[model samples]
Structure formats: C-alpha cells, structure tokens
Target: MLLGFQDRLFGLTGSGISVESGLATFRGAEGLWNGYRLEDVATPEAWDADPELVWRFYSMRRRETMAVQPNAAHRTLAAFEKRLGDRFYLCTQNVDDLHERAGSQRLHHMHGTLFQSRCVLCGRTFADSGLYERPDSMPKCSNCGGVVRPQIV
Candidate 1:
C-alpha cells in the first residue's frame, strides 16, 4: 500500500534505546545477567520449561520499563517520522515501547513487545501491562481461559 511513496526513511533501533533510557540491558552486568540466563527466560522452550520464572522476569522488566522515559534518539526518530509521515518507518529490536512514547506513529517492533501477551492455547494476542507477582495472579485469556504468556521474542 505504501508503493505510491517516492521517498522513504527507515530507522532501526536496538538495546541502545533501552540503555539510553536507563532500562538495563540483559547482558549488562547490573541487569538480568546477574540472576537469569537467556536459556531460562528468552526462549519458547524456556517459557515451556518454567513459565512462572519467565513470568517473573518479564514482569520485572515491565515494571522497570514503565519507570523510564524515551531518550533523545527515540525522540529524534519520532520527529523524523512526524516530518516524513507515511514515508517513514521504524523497526525496533528492543521490546520496550519507547518509540511509541516518543510519538512515533509508524513503527514495527522486530522483537515482540513487553506490553503484549498471547494465549498459550489459541495464540490470541492482546494488550496487557499489569505485573503478575505470582502464578495465581497471572492473567487468564478472556477468549479461551488459557494462561496468557508474554509476547517477548
């Protein structure tokens, strides 16, 4: 549908965006590196092996992300998108929604976002931002009564 545009501007972002906003990177010595392993929290197999642990990690991430704001780089990309309109597109590897917070309307998250979840049963995805401190408090899918897992990729 965007084939009509003669000019296009594409921006790609990664962990730098999160780091610039004070959201610790997983590989950082001060962050998840201290307590978790990617094999235990980042893979689908990891999620299947220990859902509660994965949930805890992701919940902590959501809380941390909610506390921070987008950095200058995010704002710059957003501004460029605003000026260029539909001619601009942004693809981000970070799961956080800093790009959206910075006013970027045309963007895609290459990695799944921390704010969305999908049912384990039917794969119906939906918006969710609340933190679950325990397995009992975890969200249940309204569509099929299955456990809703985070969309983190």
Candidate 2:
C-alpha cells in the first residue's frame, strides 16, 4: 500500500533544530528561562504593566535574531523541500526566519515569527525587519493608531 503526498512527506522542526545556528532554544540548562521570567515579558499582562520593558526585551531579541545566519541543517531542510516540492511539508515552532531564509516556502510557523508585528487595536500585521532602536521608536498601527506588538505566539 502507498500513501498520498500529504502522508508521504512531512517535516517538523523547533528551536532545537536551529540551536546550531546560534539561536537560543529557551528550554535548555542555559536557556533564557534562567535569566528571565515569563511573567516579566511573555504575557499580555506584562506588556500592559510595562510596555517599555517588553519592547526592550523584544528589541534585544530582534537584534540578536537578525545577527545570526541559517545553519547547515536549515539549508539542508530547505534543499530537501526544493527536492520534494509539494510533497514536502514543514512545521516549525521557532519564531526566527532561518527556515525561510534557508529557502523553505512550504512551511508553517506554529509559534508565529519575530520579524512581524501586529497592531493591538486594528489587528493588522506587517513584516518588520528594522530593530526597534528605542521603545519610543516602536512603530504604531497606521490603521487605528494602536500600539504594535510582536506577532509571536
């Protein structure tokens, strides 16, 4: 018996796969969990309580993520996708663009992405590559003048 395309080829990845690319996995012994608490930056309440801190945190992350490049494993996966074409499917839990940068177009980002921002009020999302140099420089929603937040899940 043979399986269909969707069932025949599948790829799933997470932060661990990109850890080799110099990105932190946030779950290992040296993960960010040791240095920062989720309550301080990962929650909506935290954002409301101190948006500056949140912005700073994300700004730092954006800077860090932008500095790194996709690793061999990432490139390999992308090549595999090109070879498999529509038969290949990828799902990632990472917020970085290593996979995308690696050239994988048939992929789904399960945890959202770091380079995208969403407007809190209008709920519009746009691609962002610029580092938020300062909290004050954070971009605002053009549609509703609302605060823009990272589009990560």
Candidate 3:
C-alpha cells in the first residue's frame, strides 16, 4: 500500500506485458523465433555472425510492433502512473512501444525499444519506424559509416 510503504521505495516489475498488446513472446510458440533460437537474433554475437539476418529478424519485429496498439492493461498502467506520479515506477521486459503509446511517463524499458536503433560503430541512437525489410535497405550510421543495429537489450 502507498500509505504503508510511504517511507520505502515502491516499484513495479513487469514481464511479458507486450503479449497482451498482440506482440509475440520471445520464447513463445512462434515459428520464427522458437525455430531459430533467441541467440541468433538477440545477442551481439549473433549480430557479429550475421548482421543481415539480425536486421531481417528485427525488421519483422518492428513491423509487427508497429501494427498493434497498446492494450487496456497498458492504458491502466499509464493512468496509474499519472495518478501516482513519482511514487510509481514501471520496468518492463517488453521492447514494444505499448507503454509509451499508452502515455506512461514514469516507465523504463528493461529490455530496450523496438522503435529505436543504435549504431554499433558510433553508439548513436535514433528513432527508426521504417521497416528495413531488405538487408541492403538497412540504414547506415552516418557518424561512422557502419551498419546501424536495433537498440534492444
């Protein structure tokens, strides 16, 4: 309770919240991820082994994330944050933008974000909503002339 824990820190830990917004879980019964394994697309080693494949995987994820809107639970969390202000905090494992779209300001993406990317060579990150379906179409980092990768943790 807020009153009971007024002198202590209160926070919320949320995992798998993105699934309620129609996004698939990483280890769910999905054909693509389960068939390929998470290491092939979610790790820095995987990106080094095959950057193109990684791009393709994240591109698909970005498209799917872009298609869905925040669910009622996400909206409720956002509303709750507005009410609780600094007393409430949200940490999520989901990479989707559902929480942000729902208007949550006191939230932290524990995994990373699907709508943003970073440069492996320069460490510059930017908002990227465009689908890079083709490997050749993947944006190049303007700062270092290196391949830009998804900014997910």
Candidate 4:
C-alpha cells in the first residue's frame, strides 16, 4: 500500500513516519520502558501524585528525542510538502520535533509535543528550552507562578 503512495501528489502519515527516525512505538511485548507501565506515568493523576517521577521519565525521553535526527522518510515527506504546498497534510502521533526539523510546515501533532511544557495549575502551555540533566529543577509558569510539567501524551 505504501508503494502505491509514491505516485500520489498528496497523502497523510502516522506513527510510521517517525519509526524510521528512531522513535519507539509504545506497543507490543518489548515496548515497555524500564519495566515501568505506561499508565503509571502517563496520566494526569500520575503528574499530580508524583510530578518528579513523571518529569524524570519525560526528561529522559526528551534527551533521546534531542539526540535523533530526521530520517529519509521524514525528509521525503518534507520534500513532498515543498512540491505540493497546501495540497499535502501531515498528522503525527509522535511527540518528537523531527517532522518540524525536517522542514514540514503543514503538520499537526495529534498526541502532543515533547518540546512543550504546561502549567499544572492554570493549564497554560509553552515551549521548554531547558536540557534534561536539570530535571530536578522545576519550571515555573510565567503566567501563574505555578510549577510546570512537560505535556507528554
């Protein structure tokens, strides 16, 4: 089915677009991360109860995401977008910024973005510029002075 897509001028993509870019799919038997369950750390309740642990997990993921570059598939889609302009649309479930780094101007993040943080109190979202080694340091919301957490989904 993918081979047939090459001739088409416009198309949509999913998680598959990022798999080749070194992002792991959070399914299957081997999908577990460090023996921790996804539900335990990837929920609003988890953040409310233990924000530090949740921040640790997301911070490590952000570090890994920062290490990888966009692969051929991402670059191809970017080139396609350049050729098709507004006719092409891209929707990605992966949170890494590879698609954006690959020059994809027309795209949407269905799940969320890894490089963004949100305030737990007021629910305000913003870009995270700090590195992962500083996980112990909590980000304060410029709007409400509340601690901010990464908005991972």
Candidate 5:
C-alpha cells in the first residue's frame, strides 16, 4: 500500500516540460539547429580542425538564446514546484536558461548550458559577457587565445 502511494505521488518530466519555455527542442521538426552537420561543429575533430568556426557557431547560438523568453510551460512548472514542495523534480535537456528564469528552484540541465562559454585550451567555463556584436575577427577567449566555445552537449 505504501509503495503504491509513493508511485503515484512523484512527478517526472522530460524535455517536453522545457519545450514550453520557448526553447528550441533539438532533434525535432523545425529545430533551430541546422546547417554544418554535427560532424563539423560538435566533435573533437571539428574543434581541432577549426576552432574559430566552432566558436562562431556557438556564439551565434548564444546570441539567439539571449533573445528568447521563458514560455507558459516553464511558468507552469515553477508554479507546480511551489505547490508540490519537495516532491517535484525538473530535468531539462535544453541549454537555454528559460527554466531558470521561470522560477524553477529545483531543476537539472542534463545536456549543458548555452549562456556559458568554456575555454578550449584551459577547459574553464564562464558566463557569456554579452559581447557578441563584434566583427568575426573579434571575440577571443578571455583566459586563452584559443577561442571560446559554447558549453553545450
């Protein structure tokens, strides 16, 4: 009897919960990610061959991420957390901060984050400085000249 009650008392959510936060759900139809397949921008080989190109791609994504806002789904989850107390857990696959902005105190980003950048040489991750409007020739890693890459999965 206790086990049955516990099973019905827990709340489980997947990427769908975050989809309501105005974030692009990758691997879905009309996803914001396209062009230059993952092979060209998401692998060790790609980083080794062309770090600048990879940085550029991630930088563009960061800029776009900054422009979006949390949607109703994100807001609803936050509200649920308020009511569920400690029984609610949110797991998001998206890198955007929509869930955070939506007031979700208990959440996890399994993939990674889009608003943060990591040093290619030192592997140090830090928040983006909101300095993405410079020319292509500009924007080098603050810690190292190795170029900053988005900390995405």
Candidate 6:
C-alpha cells in the first residue's frame, strides 16, 4: 500500500507479544493476576496507601523482565520499523524492554515503561533499572524531592 494510497503503517503490540519471550501476559495462565490484584499493587490508590508494597510488586516484575529476551515478534516489529522508517508507527501496551532490546527505535509505550521512573511532583522521568538494593529505599525526584513511582499504568 506504500504506493497505492495510504503510505504508512501502524503496529500495536500488547502483552501477548512478549509472552513468547517467557514473560507473563496480564491475564494469561502465568499472569500477574495469579498472585496480585489491581487494587493491591496496580492502582494509584494502592501506591498512595502502600508505596512499599507497590514497589515490591514491581520489583519482582522487574526481575522477571530482566531475565527474558525479545522474541521473534519483537524482532519482527523492529525490522518493520527499520524498513519503513518514519512510515511506520509502533505503539505498545507492554511495559517491558523487549521491543527496545529488539532495536525498535521509533516506539510509543502507551502504558509507560517498566525500567523507568517518573517524579510524581516534578514529572521528570529517567531510566531506573536498579532493583533497589536496600530495604525501605525508594527513589526520590532530584528536582523537587518528590516520591518517584514506577512508570507503569
């Protein structure tokens, strides 16, 4: 369709795309819901009520994400981006780093990223791949000294 009329492509990826990489989908057999509920660790109120607990939940997820690699689906999308250049747009609901690891430069993480943290007050975001070595240690925004939360939806 590049020369026909519409000369662009849009690709949307979700948790399923990362499942083949041995990662759990949101509602799959090995999903996060197996042990946790949204109200307990995936909601803003949950974070507000117990930041530590929320952090703990995400920390486990970070560990799991780190252990896996990008699967073929991720690589295919990256290849499409490479071939199409600006003509292709990719938006993903997954918060993992698989797509980026697969070399997809032009991507939009609509659900936020797992390895990133943003300041709730200052709204500044930066890469944070640490597993927070110390207990009771939470990231703080350097600008306004606000609490940093996971960049996930």
Candidate 2 colliding pairs: none
Candidate 1, residues 2-97: lDDT per residue as tens digits?
334477888888887779799877667643533677677878898889888888888988999999999999998898887789889999898998
Model 2: per-residue Cα lDDT over 38-145, one tens digit each:
667777888889776777777777788888999988898887777778888899988899999989999999978888999989899999876665757877888899
lDDT of 5 by residue, 1-153 (tens): 123223323344555655554444554563324567656866678877876666666666666667777777778778777666676677777777777888987887777777777776789888773544344754567777766666777
Indicate the residue-level lDDT of 2 in model 2: 49
Q: Which regions in candidate 5 have their CA more than 4 angstroms from the true location?
A: 1-23, 28-34, 129-147
lDDT winner between candidates 1 and 4 = 1
Task: Show the lowest summed lDDT stretch of 10 residues, model 3.
Answer: 1-10
Estimated TM-score for each candidate: 0.90, 0.87, 0.86, 0.83, 0.70, 0.88
Off by over 4 Å in 3: 1-15
Candidate 3 C-alpha error for residue 83, in Å: 0.5
What Cα-based lDDT does every candidate model obtain? Answer: 0.85, 0.81, 0.79, 0.77, 0.66, 0.85
Candidate achieving higher lDDT, 2 or 3: 2
Superposing every Cα of model 5 onto the true structure, what RMSD results? 4.4
Worst 10 residues of 6 by lDDT: 1-10
As a TM-score, model 6 comes out at 0.88
User: Candidate 2 regions off by >4 Å?
Assistant: 1-7, 28-35
Model 3 per-residue lDDT at 44: 88
Which wins on TM-score, candidate 1 or candidate 5? 1
* Model 4 Cα lDDT, one tens digit per residue, 1-153: 233334545455666666776767656466566687776667888777877777777877888788889998888888888876776788877788888999998888888888999887899999895554454586789999998888766
Q: Which scores greater on lDDT, model 4 or model 6?
A: 6
RMSD of 4: 3.6
Inter-residue clash pairs, candidate 6: none
- Which pairs clash in model 5? none
